[model samples]
Target: MTGASAGIGAAYAECLAARGFDLVLAARRTDRLEALAETLRNKFGVAVRAATADLADADQLEAFAAEIGADDTVTLLVNNAGTSTLAPVADTSVAAAQAMTDLNIRALVRLTMAVLPGMKDRDRGAIVNIGSVLGFRSLPVSTIYSATKAYVMLFTRGLIDELAGTNVSVQLVAPAATATDLWDISGVPLSALDPAIVMTVEAMVDAALAGLDAGETITMPSVEEADRLIADFDASTLALLGASQKSAPASRYLNVTA
Candidate 1:
């Protein structure tokens, strides 16, 4: 698990540890990772490794991927390391944007690539990608972060399609405003969000795992009508696309003189 030091990542580690997954926790914070590893090892009696590496750093990311590729016991990968940008585009630092891109998109893609070949060879594996409910929306302050997560959701969905008929299961877990440090970095406090809307991290993880157990590729923990809505959206979109493929312009565009 990447970003297994805290927040949603930490929650996932705790849950997965209980589910009998020996863990390799990677993150930028060595102290936190080590502490978490110790706790899980002691409590769950599961083996745990703490890998300290900043995924935003290209060298660290490559090394981490290489290490994961070499580890044969790794049957599951939890890609949970991510950050949120709270600022508007004009106010956000270029460095922060670049770092987010590196961690959220570049590192994820690289790690997935590194793990996929082995998973395919073994014919048994699973990947849980952490995404956000905000990925489906155009939030004002979190535009780029939302875009990045949208990419995550779409990327996981693409993997689901590609890995079909293989034993590898790809899941996208999209949580809705869960109690995590994501709010702090996003310029919002968890306490400030409506209590009704924000779910506890444990609840979110449980729901996500439940979705996975039920064989869902996309899991939205907080959306009550998620499945129905997604089905409708997909059907409507396909119908729209089906109508757009034509040999000539529509009647609406035919009369245009320009």
Candidate 2:
């Protein structure tokens, strides 16, 4: 599990440990990671290793991915490490935007690639990618953050098709505004948002796990009528594909002589 230090990631570690899975938790905060590891070890009688690495740094990310790739015992990978910024494109600093992209998109992709080959070889494993509902509804303030999540959503969807015949499964989880430190870090505290829209961290993780058990490719924890939305999105994608197969550009783009 990446981002295993706090919030959703820490919650996942607890749940997975209780289910008797020895864990390898990765995050930048050594203090929190080690503490969580110790708690899980004492409470669940499961072995837990805390790995501290700043994933936004290329060297650390590559090294961590290599280590996980070589671990044949790893049966599941939860790509939960991500960062965000809530500012307009122009207002956001280039360094901040790049760091968010590196952690959210680059780290997730590298880690998933690290585990996939071993999982395919073993023919039994699962990958859970945490995305956001902002991936589907982009806002001016969520420019880079939403784009990163949209990448996760599309990446997971394509992987599902690629792994169709294989025993390995991949799930994309798009959570809305969850009650996590992410809000504070993004400069938008949970109290600033509507209480009704915020989901408890535990509830979100539980629903995501239930969706995984039910073999759902995409899980939306907050959406009550998620299936209908998914179906419509899929149908629209198919329609777009069919419409794009023409030999020339559409008449709307053509210059017609009247």
Candidate 3:
């Protein structure tokens, strides 16, 4: 589990540990990763180890990848290391944008690439990408972060399609704004969000696992009725198909040349 030191990634690590899965926790923070490993080993009687790498650094991640890529013991991959940028694009620092993009998109994709060939050879594995509700909706302040997550969602779905005849399961877990370090980084007040609607970390994870068990590629824990979201997706797909027709513009756009 990459990014297993904190937040939703930490929750996934814990859940998998409790389920008696051996783990290799990867994150930039060595101390936090080691501490989490010790706890998982003590509590769940699962073998746990820590691999610390700043995934934003190419050299570090590549070295880490060489080991993780070939290891047959790792049957599950949770590519969940991510950061956030919460500012208008005009004034957003290049560092912040690059950091988020590097961790969220580049790290996730590279790690997946590293482990996928092995999994495909074994014909058995699972990948759960931690996405966000913001992946579906557009928000002004979190444009880059949201866009990266949107990529994850689509990428996971595409993988699912590609691996349909195989035992390699790919899932996308979309959680609404849960209480995590992310908000603290963004300086967004928890009070500003609807508290009643927010799901606990456990509930979110449990629901995602349920989806995994049920062979659902997409999981939305906070959503009660499935059709609601399906309808929205269908409408968007319909719009996409309509756009492909490339018809003439409406009467309003017609040139009324004098």
Candidate 4:
């Protein structure tokens, strides 16, 4: 489990430990990681180890990947480490925006890539990536963050496609703005957002697991009306199916030909 230090990641750790899975928790925060490990060990009798490393860093990431790669018992991978920035595109600092991309998109992809070879070889594994409802809906302040999550959703779906005959299953958790430290991390005061929009961490993980068990590729916890969302995504995908990429520019581009 990556991002096991706080928010959804920490909740996932607790939930999985209660179900009898040992954990190698990785995150940038050593103190919080160990603290959570201790709590899980005491409360659930699960073996927990803290892997302190900034997964956004290439060297640190490769080392952590080596650790997971070396462990044959790693049957499940939960990619929950991510950062979101709350600024309009023009106002968002370049550095902060880049950092978010590094963590949410780059690091997540690298970690998944690292685990997949072993999972494919083992023929039995599961992966759950924490996404957001914003992946489906546009939020002006969360544009870049949502784009990264959209990548996760599409990436997981593609993995599902390629791994159809394999035993490894991939699930994407698209929770609405959840009750987590993410609000603060994203520069939003928790009180400023609609309380109803927030979901508890435990409920999010539980719903995600239910979807995983049911073999769902996408799980949106707060959306009780699941069929509508599925239809929406399907319609969007169908619209794109007719898009042309290999052909030359259509007549619509003739006026701008230079």
Give the TM-score of each candidate: 0.95, 0.97, 0.91, 0.93
By TM-score, the best candidate is: 2
Give me the overall lDDT of model 3.
0.86
Assess candidate 2 and give its TM-score to the true structure. Answer: 0.97
Give the winner by TM-score: 3 or 4.
4
**Which portions of model 3 show Cα errors greater than 4 Å?**
245-258
Going through the candidates in the order shown, the clash numbers are: 0, 0, 0, 0
Q: Sorted by lDDT, highest first, which candidate order results?
A: 2, 1, 4, 3
Reference-based lDDT, residue 130, model 4: 81
lDDT of 3 by residue, 44-153 (tens): 99999999899999898888788899798879999888888777787678988888888888888888898999999999999888888888766888788788898887
TM-score order of candidates, best first? 2, 1, 4, 3
Give the least accurate 10-residue stretch of model 3, judged by summed lDDT: 183-192
lDDT of each structure?
0.89, 0.94, 0.86, 0.87
Residue pairs with backbone overlap in model 3:
none
Worst 10 residues of 4 by lDDT: 239-248
lDDT by residue for model 2 over 26-111, one digit each (tens)?
A: 99999999999999999999999999999999999999999999999999999998888898999999998998899999999999
Candidate 2 or 1, higher lDDT? 2
Q: Judge candidate 1 at residue 137 and give its lDDT.
A: 78
Clashes of 1: 0
Q: Model 2: clashing residue pairs?
A: none
